[model samples]
Target: MNTNGLKVLLIDDTVMILQRLQSLLAEVKQVSRTESATSAEEALVLMDGYQPDVMVLDINMPGMGGIEMLRKLNVKQMIKPVVIMLTNNTFAGYRDECMRLGADYFLDKSRDFLMIPSIVEKVQERNVLQF
Candidate 1:
């Protein structure tokens, strides 16, 4: 981890996915804090408080999917934290749309969960704070 005490917000609609991600990130020593949300609405509320440096989100949520949340976040002109999408949808169109909508990374849920740390690692290594 490039940052000594980085905080991350992990959001997903499923409890299982959230738990699995949390466990993967637990191995990294630099991540000092982790806040999670199961819905976009809940995540919005948490965002005002936690203000995480990085956000890993899942698209296709029940309500207020990842793209929707990004749209909402844009209105506030937030710091635009580095958002990595964890989704089952891997279509080229969806990935392109997410990038256009402010998502920095689009990853497959089935194969990318294990790479969370690596993604964060690269982001931290670049030292581009508040991406």
Candidate 2:
């Protein structure tokens, strides 16, 4: 996969969170496109039309939370996007659970929100080196 430009999918219940993350990622040259979904269910629907290279997900939602969505993605064998679980819940259980469920990165929304662009850039760099 060409990582020079990455397509990112942002899934969160909050509009502000989505907008903030989108704007932050927009500044990064590596990000070619971004799509946002207010819920995991909506994201799943969007996935049929868009295969993202990276997924920035929230752990908690009204229905079909991020963890459940991750399981569905694995079971369905969807295009394996690099999963980044970004949430305000920084509990150890959530972190471990997310990692076990195939999350590449688990970031605390409060402390790690600003690090997303750098993380995406690093993923792009790593993919470039892999090829």
Candidate 3:
């Protein structure tokens, strides 16, 4: 994996949200690549071929939600990518649950939506330092 740039996987049911995230991350120099999945199930399948360094996930989705996906990822023991929980539901309970489930960061979609790229850049910086 490149320490200078991060491969980001975006999992959200909403196409517009995914597109916006992709567009936003595209402007960040630290983000080398971006992929999107309309649902957590699709993201899990995609992870087989594409190992992302970071994941921007939504808590609400059809079929399987982000919280369930996190549990599934843990069970798979796959690469533990930096998980960022982004959602419109910013309730304290949700934030606490996501963090407890191993989310590296939790951001309110309405307020922190614009902070994604900067957060990704920071995560890249940490990766560089770790390597």
> On residues 49-70, what C-alpha lDDT tens digit does candidate 2 reach at each position?
8888899999999999999999
Worst lDDT run of 10 residues, candidate 2, spans 1-10
The TM-scores of all predictions, comma-separated, are: 0.89, 0.94, 0.94
Cand. 3 TM to true fold:
0.94
Q: Residues 7-48, candidate 1, lDDT per residue (tens digit)?
A: 899989899888888898888766777899999899999988
What do the candidate models score in CA lDDT, each in turn? 0.84, 0.92, 0.91
lDDT leaderboard ranking: 2, 3, 1
lDDT accuracy of residue 52 in candidate 2:
88
Residue 113 lDDT, candidate 1, scale 0-100: 68
The alpha-carbon deviation from the true structure for residue 90 of candidate 3, after best TM-score superposition, in angstroms, is 1.3
Model 3 accuracy (lDDT, Cα): 0.91
Best by lDDT: 2
